[model samples]
Target: MAAKVLVAYGSTNGSTARIARTVAETLRRDGIEAEALPAPSVAAVTPFDAVVVGGGLYAGRWHKDARRFVRRHRRSLAGRPLWFFSSGPLDGSASERDIPPVAAVRRMMTRLDVTGHATFGGRLEEGAKGRVARMIVHSGKGGDFRDFPAIEAWADRIAKELDNRSGGGSR
Candidate 1:
């Protein structure tokens, strides 16, 4: 049977959710069975052979439910094929090195021995964010800065990995 992969995400204004859907679609296109689900909607991790957890970053932190879901399932996930992604750095100038710090989530991920982690750019609206979030958005630092090519490339890599593990040749 094909290895099942689940892509779960948390989004504030929907950009992250869209990215998760793209990743899931990419996996499916590679002939991998994948499902994209909202974080709160995932009742169990037992069904999937691999997991991809995605979340939006806000004020330098990943969404609360995303963190909680990982923490709750960390044990079941430890031996599984696992990947993580966060979207929030909205500026073209932002890099993994230059993006805002997310110390707490980083520590949690390190503890979980996360297999892979990706950071994607996010979108921001003028009035939706709170004062501080709005300031960050308007600080010449926010836009629809997501890189779709990079996202697809990463998803391809994950599909390859799952294919190898499932004794399937690369497409």
Candidate 2:
């Protein structure tokens, strides 16, 4: 059987959603059947052979919904192959200085037994959020620094791992 992959993401302003969709699309191109859905939309985990959980970072934290989703499915997640990613650190300072979100993701991955975790640069738009969110966006450097090539490469790695787990490529 072909491997089933779930690309679950949480986004407050939609950037992370785009990243998740791109990953699912890349996986599909690699011959895996993948589904990209918001974390809240994921009602069941039994159908997927592998899971990729992603979220956006805000104020040095991930979307609460995404964290809850993983925590809720902790046991199932521990048994199945899993990957975690967060889209943030567009300014590079966070990545350079070791931000809290990165640390939090590492802790969560260790606790959940995820196979891997990655951080990707995220975008910031002017006038696209509320006062606080806008302030957070503004206080940090603004830019669309996401690296599509890196994203695709990461997705390819996930596809390969799933292929190996499923006894080489297609089922």
Off by over 4 Å in 2: 92-101, 136-140, 169-171
TM-score of each: 0.87, 0.88
Candidate 1: regions farther than 4 A off: 94-101, 126-129, 137-140
Clashes of 1: 0
**Candidate 2 lDDT tens digits, 133-164:** 68766886667767778789889999989888
Query: How many backbone clashes does every candidate have?
Result: 0, 0
Worst 10 residues of 2 by lDDT: 92-101
Q: Global lDDT of each model? A: 0.83, 0.83
- Candidate 1 to truth, TM: 0.87
- Model 1 clash pairs are none
